[model samples]
Target: MKAFPQQPTYTGFNEPSRVEADVCDLEVEGELPLDLNGTYYRVGPDPQYAPRLGSDIYFNGDGMVSMFRFKNGRVDLKSRYVRTDKFKLEQEAGHALFGAYRNPWSDDPAVQGKNRGTANTNIVFHNGQLLALKEDSPPVAMDPDTLETIGNWDFNGKLSSQTFTAHPKIDPQTGEMVCFGYSATGVDTPDIAYYVVGPTGEIVHEVWIKSPYNCMIHDFGVTRDFVIFPIVPVVSSAERAKAGRPTFGWDGTKDIYLGVMPRRGTARDVRWFRAPNQFASHVMNAFNEGSKVHIDMPRAESNMFPFFPDISGKPFDRERAAARVTRWTLDFNSKGDTFEARQMTSLVGDFPRIDDRYAMESYRHGYLCVSDLTKPYDALRGGSITGMFINCLGHIDLATGKHEEYFVGPTSTLQEPVFIPKSATAAEGEGYLAVLANRHEELRSDLLILDAQRLADGPIATVHLPVRLRQGLHGNWVPATAA
Candidate 1:
């Protein structure tokens, strides 16, 4: 009899180890994949943010979330932690990821009462001054450089009582600021709808864009002439029950569509760009029905459950394979609709951020997605492998359908990848992607930097943190100039 060799057993990690990496010294740069020398910081926990009872976890600010301002070689933090108490904190600041506080005056009952939650939101730099949108009070004006509250935008009449999702898009051609609202609060009739505001912060139009579909607006991108919106149709009994509505069925074949319209166009102008069907549900990341418009989604997958399965580990067994990669370009011309698309299951991602650009243009590459396969109704109460993994940034050239893959790590749960350029004054072609890797319940998060240009290149630097970030909604990179 011969003795058999033993195989190495898999030891699950509790957190990613930063010691297993090296740093990139910025002084010697010749197209390095990722700069290892880039500095990392924790802006701190969001006190103003909290999640809804049964909805997916959200970055709501009851006051705890803080804003980290980076400059020269240092990081500065501003937060509501000291201003409000845990018992009186706001649920989620009006803005997602970007911290913009809520207006304390809106009479909407969902945001009223002692539990009337306010939130920290984002500051949009508009017309020399920064405009801060929130979940309460009035829109606060701030100095982008000093982050000082300069003034507030004035509005007449009570603002609509609805959960307004999606960032306001400006009509590059017309200059009108555009925004929309979807009501999940159960206060309004016919459910979801939209609106538009002027640059001075006056409500221009609020209209209902409804369908029998009962869908939520996911991610929306704006162009010179039109606003491109991605709508996800979901049928959740728990959601209806939670919102105090009755459960209804949606036709599975009714495809999702990208709503296209002029920046100031009427509801009639707001028509479906293609057939109401979205390319596929599996490929979308950080999505919600109409409640969440656009996310900083950098990568694509076939199905969310496959990656982050509930405790049961049974794949999206009920739904047949409905995801097929398709290329559809939408033109939201006010006069009519224009779309040029090709259906293909190959190019599987959208909204790629490139070197030193905002999410719209900065498809820099790299995506960190959390997949907890366990069902919300199932075993999470017992704890399990809520799915987590990292896919190397994918390079897509839709013009030619040419694609390339970069450093995809093994079974590690990661967060949104923020691109950090090599220099304090990093121009194009000198940026790197950074991510927070949790490595599947390695409960702590590890800060990692990867070569943006070379995906195959290993980690340039790794920073192990001392705390645990439950799940982050969204975050942005502030270079030294703004720090």
Candidate 2:
């Protein structure tokens, strides 16, 4: 038996539930839509063994992939480990061979030169295959139906980069997956590889570019005309990794840059627009109106992850870290270096999602998990390991500038909400939201199905789970016809 650390990351609702199960006919509270068919796949960090260093961040755990299959109004769940190289090595040794998160220098000597991907960030289905992603390594392909690990996929031997982004945008019109890999050459390098994968998983186009600085480019934006990469101040360096420090840290001195390049252009055509120091991640949606491009995302004034401390030695400021939905507009006609930014909502939240059908086009209807600090919270039940209590689901109507939220009770928190269109041709925002709610007191989770148009009305159906899933980063829903 292994004993995990008693820290908050390993106790209470955050405690590791290393369970692989196949459950059928889950109890439902309300009527599930007959059209609600397909699978909701989510991947999160669930460490298989206690950390070799006796302590670890929640992001450093092993990859656990969970799939909820819906068929004929019945739901079934199947979960299994991703079986990455790191997972297999540690499983064979019966102990952890990896070290700190993204710090290869700290890994044990025996596991040197091996892939360190956790595949724990997000799971996306592309070209008939499920890709388990960690951003630092190539995608781990899995069977879409069985959820069985296939292997590390390299686009049938075309992807030369060592890394691939966990967040890949699928164009509804062209059916192409637009993705890029930062630090493409190595762990802390500035090289980024941009790829456009066709509908059949073939590499349509690949371009190599250099970032203005080495930073954590977790997510990016893509419109019909251009791809936007926000280079924030979460800086990383080779020296820091060699010194065994955290792979990334907040550098307030660096200015934020949004690199915009034509969808079919080369690296030389890339334009770097500058902005003041701030933190932004997880794009909501991006579209263009002729020469001007708009990107909506959650923006904060400072670092959000406390584990990645400030490089300047400044203590993390919780107030400044509250992220709000903000829209940034960049004009190609203007010669200026700065873009216009406007806060779209007052809700403090991250993990934004929009209807997939209208992606890369002028559209509305966005969903996210909101952390309403004004509401009552049960601290005794404990909050997330990130030290935030996300207790609400927010619906953002960009066209009307209206924000509506549904608060889950004081004893529970919510994960990222994914939008499920009612039908293939449903109007924009005419869909349902699949959100996972963590019941802290019960030590389990419930999947809430809410009408996206009337979010405040609460869940129309709640799918209960017997086991508690660790806080997950992101997930997506695949329609039955597509799956």
Index of the highest-lDDT prediction: 2
Best by TM-score: 2
lDDT of 2 by residue, 142-162 (tens): 998888899999998999899
**Which lDDT tens digits does candidate 1 get at residues 48-105?**
2222322221223322232434333333333322232222333244322222112122
Candidate 1 structure lDDT:
0.40
Error of 1 at 415 (Å): 0.6
Clashes of 2: 0
**Residue pairs in steric clash, candidate 2?**
none
- Give me the runs in candidate 2 sitting further than 4 Å from their true place: 381-386
